[model samples]
Target: MSKYFKKADLILFIIILALSVLGFILLRKPASDNAQIEISIGGEVTEVHNLDTDAEYIIETEHGYNTIQVKSGQVRVISADCPNKDCLNFGAISKEGQIILCLPHKLAVRIIGGEEGLDAVSY
Candidate 1:
């Protein structure tokens, strides 16, 4: 061939670069430092916690009990009396949109503004 790199190759490279930059912008995640945690029990909002400070919280509902620990702008379920320790094993989450769910206890712990994916309109 006369050319080692054709015009098609250059066009393809430009297309890939453009797509990568667009993808990065579209999927950019929210910062977790200013995020908040939402605790939902039995489909109701039980508590809200700010990630700026460290604290410990005990949750007791008609279903069961759970102990939540927050430190260094991260949150996790440390202890739970539920039969399964699934929620406790979720570990610490310092990212937006992370979640810990306790099915038997009907509890859901999630961080707001931490989703690292495209939103509804973008999706």
Candidate 2:
């Protein structure tokens, strides 16, 4: 290759390497533990602990009933007594969007941020 072309290629390669290193450094973030999910029942929210690795939950509502099971680091509703049972069919949700709702009891199970010394309520 010509001398000019060789120099240009080297410069391009160095620029690319520098950019990659910078991107890696800038994009890096400290790893955080799994968030502690809060369970809300009857307008009262509380943290659930000692979750059974293979434990299942039963939610009863005036409208219907729903069963939830936890496995593989995720929670899901397995069955329901409601006519539609649509919520039970929602499958398992591990991310923020996943929710289990029992219309009859007005109960909801969802994943929320971990207890980071945050206040329970604000006036």
Candidate 3:
């Protein structure tokens, strides 16, 4: 029984070490530098003249209102008229699958990136 236990422990340690090394390798890889597109629910598309300027756009929906800001090379929600203010607290999300939801406004903000052109992002 003791021999079997020792072998099992060794196997577990080897597996853990392998996983740690794999994780480190993955973490060392460079991140993707893709341009992000901003979409607003029930809002019209407008061109921002000044790329260096920081501006906020207000979006009003049936549920509530939200303030979106464009800064640096990204866009994010700065504030919202929701009760919990959770949407505003989300700060910014640049990766795929990351989303900002304002239940009051029935609004959702997401990042979409790919090789092909985006046809549309559905709820």
How many steric clashes between backbone atoms does each model show?
Answer: 1, 3, 0
**Which pairs clash in model 3?**
none
Model 1 stretches astray by more than 4 angstroms: 1-30, 114-123
Once fitted onto the true fold, the runs of candidate 2 whose alpha carbons sit more than 4 angstroms away are 1-32, 50-52, 61-64, 117-123
lDDT of 3 by residue, 6-37 (tens): 87788998999999888766533322344344
Predict model 3's lDDT versus the native. 0.61
Off by over 4 Å in 3: 1-34, 38-55, 114-123
Which of the two, 1 or 3, has more TM-score?
Answer: 1
User: Candidate 2 on 45-112: residue-level lDDT in tens?
Assistant: 74363222456766555555667677765777788776666667667666543466666556677755
lDDT of residue 42 for candidate 3: 41
lDDT of 1: 0.81
Q: Pick out the ten consecutive residues of candidate 2 with the lowest summed lDDT.
A: 28-37
